[model samples]
Target: MIEEGIVAFSGWMTNFELLSSGWRAGLIVFGLVFGTATVAFMVSRVIAAMERKFIETRNIWDDAILHAIRLPLVFFIWLQGVYWAAEVAYYYSEADVFTANDALLEIGFIWVVSWAVLGLIKQIEQVLVSPVKMKKPMDYTTVNAISKLSRMVVIITVILIALQTLGYSISGVLAFGGVGGIAIGFAAKDLLANFFGGFIIHLDRPFKVGDWIRSPDRNIEGTVEQIGWRMCTIRTFDKRPLYVPNATFTTIAVENPSRMSHRRISETIGVRYEDIDRVSGIVSDIRSMLQNHDEIEARQTLIVNFLAFNHSTLDIMVYTFTKTSEWVKYHEVKQDVLLKISDIIIGHGAELAFPTQTLHVADSVKLKHLEHDFGRDQGRGDTANEAGERSLRDNHEEAVSQQKSVEKHYAKPR
Candidate 1:
């Protein structure tokens, strides 16, 4: 009995020793996890602080980079901690299978890596799309399309890689997807057409994002807001959104007003007929003003001429082009020129014409001959009326017969 009791006590002591060692290992792993997590937290804070400082003084690329990487960095920190903790626990506990814990860490690693790669892609896109970053900047539409396509490719590749790592048969999956894609292609012909149209638009460089385009063939005119894969979103002047199919751009004529070299100002100036003698001077002064004005284009046509005589007044024409292509600036320049022309005309003692008519009368003797002769008509009595009625009846019957003859000759048979 004494020997049996010693044997039992020895087994209990061994189990207690194993428990103590595992507790020590767990404490060490806890310290490691906490220390690493604290470091990661401090690093993230530092990055955030730097981003804020950059925003206050420098360009935004630094801020964008930090923003994109922060999540992935934090995720990787936790994954590393978990991995080290599992390794410590396995060594202390004498367990042979770390399958479950390793699997979780591995999956987390994949997610972190994928996220980091995607973040880098996003940073690249943001930098490239920034208007101030590049000297020869690409338009927003093209950059946006390329970004989306790249992201899709990256995501698909990452997903497939992860699946393969997890013992998935990628060949069967790809074959199925290929067959399904063919079926879907047939089902969505119009959608594919629009997709290709969008691709062509990006390649051919038509109207870009933010451009004001007008369709002469259709009722579409607006500022481009988003160029999507299937369609483009246009915000009209009245502040309504219009979704136009990409295929429509390929079929119709689009006028991009944003690309115009200049804005035109054409007007007709009518003057009082009495001021017709001053018209030539007014035109000469206007032409001089246009030629000397800073906003008027030097190469474009400038016309200030006496156009023609109207029913009530003489007309002058003013036609010119502004140097600025922007609408607001063009209007400002136009108003200044118009105001100057008005001042010049008023200073010359000439008035802008309104519609008017004039009538003249002859002497009273000639006016009397033109008066109605009612007394002569009163002398021609009922005899004249009866003769007129008989002649009118004969003419009416003859006209009716001629009309029926013409209708019978030309009308279609039933």
Candidate 2:
């Protein structure tokens, strides 16, 4: 259809034979420009319709291809139109300005082709990482790495091709690059290290984008936002962005909490010394509770035993794992487990421990001391005795009040 249109335009141009060559060339240039615009517009509309149609289909390649070629196709049309126009003008006027027309056309074609390929790579990368487009989306880090490497390969190839087209010898260019690479590598050694580090990360698959990672070796604890060639961006818990060099991951030991199967719940509950006899029963009930609980992972190691005789309490060690690795949900499960344990202790008529001390004295010693004090007061007279009695009564009342306050502070809900 395009060839037929061009032939018809040629027939129409021949009708202006009476006009001068310059006038003929100018008219042809105008015609080519108009044709280019019209063709480009039509192509864009067609591609848009095709994109909408292909989007509904399960196959993503058609959509990606259509999207990739839209702009480049239009550019190619304009390039050919302008090249033809210049050729016509040069043929008529024999101007030196249009001498590089062939070279320009070749270079332009290379650029447009490379541009489309790069666009296609980008589209495929996006499609693979999109959950809606793919049933099982590819890893973002892997897709990104592949896309970048593909684009780099396309660009380097285009550059070499363009140089060859411009009459530069391919072997000579390669030889020059080989000699210059050593200097370039040394000058950008850190950059090369970071790039290689990123490449290693992509290969090793230790952690990926969006993983919550922490490093004990450094203060790197955050959700990975992006893994770039030079640096990895992490968003910390406090919502601050941390830019760490990619090389840092090569040396540091990263803990990926996001990849954990379960979150641990390890706690030590202490009961009053008076409840020592009930310790065995309490531990037994706790172990049973953990084994039967819905949130706890029964398959994991679950231990509930009387661990130690603490100064003020009998400590029971509760070591278990929750079924979920989610931070908030794990905490909720832990809270429920702790509350249930508390209830079990209460049901067994046992109380949680608090610091306390008891002192024992012989009754004879107490009586002798009281008697001596009383005798001394009597000798001092009735006024001294009354004062002593009042002080003793105040002290007793104060002690009782303090005891009640302490009991109130430690009181638990039924």
Candidate 3:
């Protein structure tokens, strides 16, 4: 009876000891989690307050920095607080404590890198909006190229840091990465080429976002929409978007029409050949109209004798330039010039030419008709010569009338 009672007491004591130890361990873990969370919360609030104070100060440089480096940076600070608190409690931590730290460091490094990347992007944005005027406006292609490159650089940096934190030997990893990178670069040669091409475009600045450009290689004309690492997108006047390789842009001759201060206008004007005597008067009138006109800014006039003869028309080219680059205004100027020229041409008492062909039959047919009318003429033999002459004159007049009627029917409209 004594032996059995001692065994029962010992078993009860062992069970109680286990229960107490488990409760204490659970409490310690709970305290560590709670303490880390509390520290993180406090750090976040401090960062937010500092950011708010900085914003309220209204310093331009400080505002840019605070605005650029706020949210992500504050989160990074919170992460650091949690990491530090975890370190402080590591003495009482479980067997997986070091592994947990590694994970936390990985996450923290990524956040830190992300924050830095965002700051860089914000800096670029500020530069674009800077009051310092550029020779050309900032283009979407340039902005995109810069942004994409910055992101790529940040990604590489983050990945390197992550590898380092994950127990990778930095030197060995880099050496292996160099070889692997070479292979990947070869595989993605076109992509890398385009990325570099986009970089060159941003630096060179062939065209801006709203500027119209035409490619010499391909007759494609459009305005730039976006510049990407591999390609650039252009929105055509017809509202179609064109995706072109960045490398091709560098190679092609791009004509930016919007960059010009004015558009060049050249047209040919046709006047009747009979108006040769009044050509000078017409030219002077046209010149005066162009010089005084509100739309056209005439540079100089050239007497371009395009066609010496067009059977009925004379071709003269009216070479000129407009001051405005607007398409609608250009059309208005052209229409005005044409109308004035047409009025002047008609007022000169000269009609434009029409094609006419004179047909002649053999003299035998006339002789045959004359023979048939021999009897009638013989009866009036005394006045035969006079009567024949009058009849022939009337017939010639009628033939001339018929030819004019045919010519007028086939004439082209002015």
lDDT top scorer:
2
lDDT of 1 by residue, 1-414 (tens): 423543464457577775465556666688869988897898889888877887775665677777788888887887887777776666566587755676777778888877877887778777787777756666677778888888888889878877777778899779888999999999998999999988888888788889999998999999999888899999999999999999988899989999999999998887788897788899999999999999998589988899989866687888999999998898899889989988988989998766543333355733343232223334555355554554456555766777677656644311
Give one digit per residue, the lDDT tens place, for model 3 in 249-308: 877888988777776667656666667887767667766666776766655453334545
Model 3: lDDT to the true structure: 0.68
User: How do the predictions measure up, each by TM-score?
Assistant: 0.71, 0.86, 0.67
Question: What does the lDDT read for residue 172 in candidate 2?
Answer: 99
Model 2 bad stretches (over 4 Å) = 1-24, 356-388, 401-414
lDDT of 1: 0.79
| TM-score of candidate 3 against the unseen true structure | 0.67
Give the candidate order by descending lDDT. Answer: 2, 1, 3
Ranked candidates, highest TM-score first: 2, 1, 3
Task: Please list all clashing residue pairs in model 2, or write none if there are none.
Answer: none
Model 1 TM-score (2 dp): 0.71
**Global lDDT scores for all candidate models:** 0.79, 0.87, 0.68
